[model samples]
Target chain A: MRPSKLVPLAAATLVAALAAFPLSVARADDAGDHADARPAAHAVHDLWVTVQQLAGGDSAAQHPARPAPQAVPAGGPTVNLSDLSHPPDIDAKLHAIARLPAGAVRLTVPNGQARLGDYSIGSEQTSTGDLLVLHGNADVFGTLRGNLVAYDGDVTVHSGGVVTGDVLAIGGLVHDQGEVDGEVRTLSAATPARTAAPPLSAGALVARNAAGVVGVVLTLLALGFGLVLFGRPSLEIVSDTVSHSFARAFVTGLIGQILLLPTFGMLVVGLVLSVAGILLLPFAVAVYALLVVVGVVGGALAVAYAMGETYTRRRLARGAMGSPNGYRYLVVGLAGPVAIWLAWALFGWVPIAGDLIRGAAILVTWLIATAGFGAALLSRAGARESFAGRIIPPEALTDEYLWATPQFGVPAVRRPGKR
Target chain B: MSGSRRARGGRRGGRRGAVALLLLLPAAATLHAQTMMDASASRQLHGESRLDARIDYAAGTLRVAPADAATLYRLQLRYDRDRYLPLARYSAADGRVALGVETTGGPGLRVSSREHLAQEATVALSSRVDLALDITLGATEGELELGGLRLRSLSLRNGASRTSIRFSRPNGARCSRASFSTGAAELEVTGLGNSRCAEVALDGGVGRVTLDFSGDAAGDTRARLDMTLGELVLRVPRGMGLRLTSDRLLASLETAGLTRRGGAFVSPGYERAMHHLDVSLSSTLGGVSVEWIR
Candidate 1:
């Protein structure tokens, strides 16, 4: 058969086998119960005694209580007399013996074979039928027409031994040296004796978590640096909004988040009602995702910048030596948030405290994001807008000219040395 | 009769009437608590050409039909205010419109022991646009008439609802795939041949299902039906060549006017028919019957 066809057949067989496993186990349990309820039968006991005697180098004549053969009925089926104690059908008898529970039977085949640690079939001898061994080793040096099977014991066929049928070892091993006309199969014994590996050390686990946190922090820093370089203006506006009107921006952002779903719903409704609207849905979804991302990054930057501004202002008032430049602002803004996040990640391993700190960080980050989004909206997407809704008069630009506006085409002449 | 006897009888009647009045108060209060809610929305098609639509509903009677050509889709809803109403969203961009309706209460809302809310939606698909449709239902009765529409793909899912979907006319475009899955629902799809899809799949749990393949076949089609503990009935047109294979455990199969060949059942003259259909059924704990129709 082709491999493809064989695969499904093998799978089906496996499924059937698994389905029957529980039933077979239950049957084995019942048989065990029955065995416990009764003493060993005399015939079986005598068979074991004969095996033991043979194993001890006793001659067959020493055991006179060997099982007697039963007479065959006239004109009945022909019975093999070589082993009168066994059934006429040698194959059937061997199968039945094999089906018995482990250790239930100790078999010495040929009725009088020499019981070395291993039984051997001589090279000069040719067996007409299959050889069956139970809980014992079998060594074959001669030819046989039928299979050689061992249960819970190994089977070895040395050089010059030829078998026309299969060689099988159940819960055992096979060592084949001679030519076999059929397949050789062995089933390994069940395994439950292996030990499991020990758990990792506490230090190793902590190191792993720390590595994960470092990786995340590095990635975030790279992204923050990119935002600072390319999106400076928008970032500045959001940070300014957070510094000036943090509470109002936060409330607006919260409201916007709450209404986001409803607005998307409305958009979908419009799309369904208008076939032409379908073309715009994808763009709208993309824009929405972009907005959220920008809001979050801007909010984080704003928080960082606000902190930097406060610290710089305090230091400058105290006559400290530090340049307050764009680069300093960017570095402080980026590092502040990253440090907070890293702290959150580290404390996350501290049982209850870790959970509380992580939750607080998440809440604070969300608020910052909303506040930044509100700020972005208030700034009209980074466009400059006058609070008074009017341009300042040129006269107002000159000192001591607040009351008198500067006239066009003429420079304002300050009063000569009013000091 | 004496005057005192008459007076005592009147008093006893009055006491019984007062007791009856008190018993009816709670029922009256419940009736007063129910409120009627109405909502409707519509939008016009401008430049978009394709639509992706999803309708999610729970615990209501829903009806869907093709709309007249003036708009892309229109929805009309009437429900009890005490219960959740469906929220609708429509967005169009990049030549694709996504329209969806979900219950405001979402899946967490517990269905109250009251009358089922009534909700009806009439959607008109523009012949100019191709569509992908998805519907999810929870314990809601649904009727869908989806025919004469340009469809790309369609999917329907339901839980403990009786839903019937029909295609009264052939689809304008060839559909890629159509599928339905339900839990303990009596689902019937008529004119499946009109769906003009290369593949159709149905999965049902503990409910009766009828799939009628009676519409004109746009091309050769394959169908897969899987059920756990439910009866399935299939109707196939006699003129079409059919090959049916069933994998069943603890279940039986009955075929009418079909010959069992190898592991599959085939209709007579299947080899010579112009159009062919392949059906696969996997069912447990129920019977499948296939009947040929002209």
Candidate 2:
């Protein structure tokens, strides 16, 4: 390739890659942002804890003999230090304690002690049981026979310091320069664990399901009416194709479904190999998806029209008195699937029976949709009417031919006695 | 007159039905919900001389590093509670531990996306103990820093991930072998010399790979790399004796500083260099390029 060709090719390749980059890496970017936010949150939490501790200390000094009250939280005011295994539970406990009103707050640590501010253990000192340190770093210069937990603070195990149990620092880091006979952990800024939403009641579930079904039916009805108003001729052709060549339409739809992925793969590979056509890859993909959606949806609606037309003509043949039009045919055809779906929507809360009904509804809908899709393909999206049973042979085209087709509700004429 | 009134009544009913449908659409959309939670678990070192650690993470970001001398193993996780369960099972009898996340009957074959970020895990293993580590990743971005740890043997199975295994410092113990099997991933192994392994093997499937051999080498190393597709970039120290034998059918080799010697490629001072490296590569469709690192 010449330089002139190469430059544009390079530019196109760059543009294509840039355009495709977000689809592949958008999630990664969001993940990175979340990771970055965590550290910032930790810093903010530390600052808040520091200010609160300072304010609390001054207030404690003012009331020399006053005993601080316990702060009530979901995990209760007391944090049991016996088991330091589940960190989130401990975090929840401490998170509540940390949010206590700024003044001195008392925490009950069973079999251990709680410190309000920065705390330290001397080289000669030995503390037993689990120790809870709040709003400050815990410097361990001596042996701690129990677990050490620092909430909104750091924990440092210096040389010669020995911790017999686990050391955990919430919203902080663990700087271990000494031996810990147990595990060490550092948890990032605390966020409450979100549990799955409560299951809906049977009545509520039915209501939701019914609403979903109604929304879908109404949307389809609206689309069907538009098709009737704007594209009745093509729609009728496709609908007639479905009624006349249901079997052929169904087989074609099945083959189309099976070939969808392979066909897409081939198209992509062909475009990519063509090099210059790579610039049109994204547009090609979008167009392919749009075509598939149109085929399936439009075909399904056409099937409904065929169904409604069949039903209405039969009723009219029986001398039923009612005005007939494309709109009524669409409405009548749509009612078939809607009725099945409504059955599911109303009784879907009935466990086994509901699931069975839903499955059947899906199967029937797919059956009709496949037939519709096949009809659309056979009729060339209503552009060709070969399979629509509307073709009249040149020799058979007489004044009686129009009357012979009673689908339009015109009464059929009798043949001559001589014939 | 009655017929006309019936038509008006039907129109009014149609208008009411449209309004009802508009109200139903919003209620239909409130059915989706997800939950994320955090959990941590660890085990203390108790005179254990060796350990077999297995990590199985399905998705998200993973980090594995050497823990403090006092702890045997530790894992911190933030995961989708509805989709996965935190795994931290330890068998004291066999000196083995399983750490990471496991599926809780959730959808299988989850691809990397924004939801993956919510499931993260950090695993730390003791540097004091001899370790045989096995890791499996799916749709993950991982960093496994194995340096400064006593590694006996290593095996990693990567699935559709971007991962880097780095030996930032010299291994504390001699490793028998390190094997990696990748599936459609971008994998990089840096400071291969520091890994202190007698043999390194990589089986790659359709992804780019970079192998950097730069550090203090104790002895001659043997590396076997097999790539089905994608590029492989090799970085070796300038003063190393490098001999490469390749079985490539549709792959290109770029040996800028190496001479072809009887169907094999060899560095200038292959016979007398301080450190020796022998590489046998098999590639079907891709390109392999060698770079000399100082």
Candidate 3:
């Protein structure tokens, strides 16, 4: 291979290797996150009672014929030991038990036994069901016919120790020197239970949706006021175009939306192929996206203006007392779409009715936005008036013609042929 | 430069930096938005012998290594609990274990970004038992180290994933075969000679693949490679004899150090070498490159 090509190839290989290395060993922080969360501490009592019994020591003499596993004291907690899965639930239960006083820390393991402090079972001894050990390590040298769960302690299955079921050590590790027929799980820290909150009530849902609708309307109103303040002429032209050529604008907007992605992709590919244009690729993409957003949003606002103006004009014609102004027109125009959304928000939690209203609102909003976008395109972002029905005849501008024409309201029809 | 020109340049640079930061802020928010759950599970080795292990991972980074002889299998997983649940099930009756992550619902279309599904799982398998291992991956980056394991057979299937399988040390048992099937994935297998497999098969569709046979070998082996598109690179041990037979359509081969013998390429001293690697390759619209390594 050529040296020049080799340099780039080697660099590429290095980059790839560097990128893969992190993905392979990037969980250092995760370990810290889990390790820092310590489970609640359980009071320690009757420590290593099982070990003493196993050795036939003083504690064993007190229980001559294997006395029934009793609580350390009265009114203690009881834990179910049938299933060892779902660590978070078990952690919560254990934490609740841990909070009890030392004398009241007795535990009831359903279908099994619960022991506090260090526990053990010697070889030749066989136990049944599950065993829960808290605040101490579990040393097993015998046969356990069921699961073994150790909380805040280690589990050592010594030689000849046989467990017929799963073993779990929470907040500790498992030292396996013996045989286990089931799964062994060691949790360094008991993760908190999943916080998937319950569903909200219908009233709460309605209130939330209403808040969202109000926020959206407020934002749109601010944008419309700014447009009226700075570029009323452009807004007026676009509004007029939407009123005069609504269907044409809608068709153009639909086509533009369909071709948006393909056009962007083509622009990108063309730039890459033309190496010099690659430098301008990012700027070009940003500009293109900005233009699209401006057209769509500005057009929607223009449509609202047109709607408000028409309504105000009709009200004025019917002798309703109201100021005819750009701000008033925008406000009136925006109220139409906002009212649809308001209806949706109010009834959106009504099952089928809510969904139907929401769908109608979305459809109406999309129609208006699309027509507005098309009008913006046809009027060249309000720079052109060809689609706004603003063209005038040259004869109308003549001096004699201007003198005869009415300056306000409707142009008085030429007075029958007097002109 | 004039003072005004310098000032304008500095302002432009500052504006660009602000824009870049603004663009990156959302990406940072997205990375921190998802919650990852960490869980680990293992099983102690018992008197039982043979085992069958299956791993199915939908997305993320996966690492598999040989575990201590005392452990049957151990899995440490960090996953997105919202979409997936960790799996650790073992059946002592058939000596079959299934370990990995399963979707919360059934396998639906995954529309999230790779970062959102950034789950990680590390699996360690026992080396004492005769093992049949199978792995299936989707949109994953996997590093499987299968050396020092008593592996009997191996099968890997991946979709749009990058997976590298390495046999750093020789297998404890003779492997019957190793097979790989990929869909638009970049897969690399290193130290294949250490696998001690009699037969190796690879089926690829539209992705770059590298198979490196640069480890100590015990006996002769055969490989059948079929690729539809993209590139394939083969790294051969210098001491091992190589025989390559290819069926190609619009694909190019660079047999730099091998002799073209009739319809196939043969390494030097192929007939006298201690072990031979017989390869039959079929490819379309892809290039195959060969590199001899020590």
Candidate 4:
């Protein structure tokens, strides 16, 4: 709080801020390049893949990073670190790993492999099967030799182990507890983007903004339609019930996302199959058609929600009826149809955006539907009290609710608007 | 904020509204309120994934960043061999003119600049200056173009954008290995009659590329085309030994004194067979043809 004393502190703070670049560059020495890429972005697409898996009735949750985490097999890859003294059974069995920097290789199960360069010796890295080795950390354990590239990772060399190429983990941290004769080419770069980069083009800016607006509108409409179909009062009851429970809603949402996405992909596949089957397989086309309808409804619902939020009439009417009843709604009025159609038109023209919208629609549908269910249950009050309550479900959150009761699939009724 | 303004106004609260109403307040005019910092043109080299480079003296160095990642291009000119000066920073974020090479380096360097319509980083120079351009184009549609400059190495990463670069100035000097993979972009050397190189391999994603020899090759050249799904076209001069291979290759383009031996085209330069050859080819999928021109 001392005004004069703040000078040193200010100077120190500035120094610290300026030091970020150099420190980051130095710290990047050990950090995982792949790790920095992050798996969050993949979640959306992979979840859709999982949805496809789930809709086809296949076990998609089994795969990691999907909405529904698939249960890993009982006999998963065993990593007994205590027994890490010996080389993994190369021919015995090892998990198929690929593009692993040139020194991080251990075998235990059956897998495939591709190695570039030579990490053990100079010029290039050797290769082996199942386990792909990159020469970031150039140390070979046991007796392994093959073509693996020693790019930028460190290497670990066991006493009896040997490699064939140069371990070029130049800027990366190199543990010299190994042996290699190949030269190291040090590639140094100046400070990278210290701040967030500006958008390269105006169109990209417009595109991102548009996507956000469209997504928000879609999310709101889903809630509105749910209210309209189930009736206002019931939706209120369910919504309140769900608001009381945080744990239940999170888990249910996670599970639902896992189940719904891939359904569209499978529908596409089914459509393809139906085309192949011609008129003989009417069921495929019918199923595909059903999915299309749901997609259309979901998108229309989103547009309607955007409209209702932006428009005064619907916002006021919905407010009187309460939030839960608002969601039990659908597209209405000329403006509603036009907005919805415009969205559809944009999506149709851009295939990439269209696919993205399809996925977004599915996600939005699930989000609002559950939220709707929670709202209805909340207004009704203990609508699912009959069911055994281990804990509160998604329909009973303190802030927002989705279910009229604790059970997952149950939908609640709507209520009438206030005078 | 409104409440605080009212409190400050005390007896003359009405005046506060007038104060707020004024545009560009006298007091505020002097105050430097916080605002967004300007985005200085920055091209930090994201270490390349693939290194396939060569060296030959041409005009200026063509610095390329060939990935979807926002890449800032730079120029490192040195007073001596070990130093450099910063030129400019550019990014291939827009599918519209992301990179353009101005033909205004130290004279005798005829730099014809053209920024293509694609999200890739590239700078094409067609001059006669003995300058070295270090390029770092990524593997995501990341491409680098060199018409008359010397290169060191061409690097690439896994699943990166395809890279295709053609080394021209066919008769000037020769280069070493030009390795490409993942991303699809290439260097199509043309107008170079009898030019040659050490080794060339077009890996997967190292897509539809061509190393055209307009007239002829310089010395004995060695080239290999490795493609998973794209195309590769090589133009051989008038007469020379030709060698080409793949899962399937079509010799629709004619090459004199070239006979099929095994699955490879045998055009032995025998030495320096990449001079004075006009080879124009389009592969439907993945096709490769290597021939030695006169």
- Per-candidate TM-scores read 0.38, 0.49, 0.53, 0.28
Per-residue lDDT of B156-217 in model 2, one digit per residue for the tens?
99999999999999998999998989998999999989988989899998789999999877
Over 4 Å off, model 4: A1-336, A339-419, B1-145, B150-159, B162-168, B183-195, B205-216, B229-241, B247-294
DockQ scores of all models, one per candidate: 0.01, 0.13, 0.25, 0.02
Please write out the lDDT profile of model 4 over residues B1-294, one tens digit for every residue: 597776777747657667675754866744532111111111222343222222111223233422223222222221111112122322223211122222224333212232111111123332222222343333233334444443333333324334334444442445554444445455444433332445545455434556564443454445555554455556665554445443434323343455566754455453464322222223333545555444
The CAPRI class of candidate 3 is: acceptable
Ranked by TM-score, the better of candidates 2 and 4 is 2
Ranking by DockQ: 3, 2, 4, 1
Instruction: Compose the digit string of candidate 4's lDDT tens values, residues A189-238.
Output: 22332466664454564466567656765665555556456644433334
Cα lDDT tens digits, model 1, A319-410, are 99998855566566556555656666566667788778778867766766677767666665545432112345544364655337545655
Candidate 1 iRMSD in angstroms: 36.0
TM-score of 3: 0.53
Ranking by TM-score: 3, 2, 1, 4
Instruction: For model 2, name the residue pairs that clash.
Output: none
Stretches > 4 Å off in candidate 2: A1-419, B1-33, B42-51, B68-74, B90-95, B109-112, B126-128
Every model's TM-score on chain B: 0.85, 0.90, 0.86, 0.42
Docking class of 1: incorrect
lDDT of 3 by residue, B1-294 (tens): 999999999999999999999999999987756566676788877776888999999888899999986888999988776677678878878999999988879456354765555678999999999999999999899999999999999999989899999999999999999999999899999999999999999998878999998777779999999987769999998889999999998789999789999999999999999999999999877889899998
Interface root mean square deviation of every model, in Å?
A: 36.0, 4.2, 3.5, 17.0
Better of 3 and 4 by TM-score: 3
Assess the local accuracy of residue B129 in candidate 4 as a C-alpha lDDT between 0 and 100: 24
Candidate of highest DockQ: 3
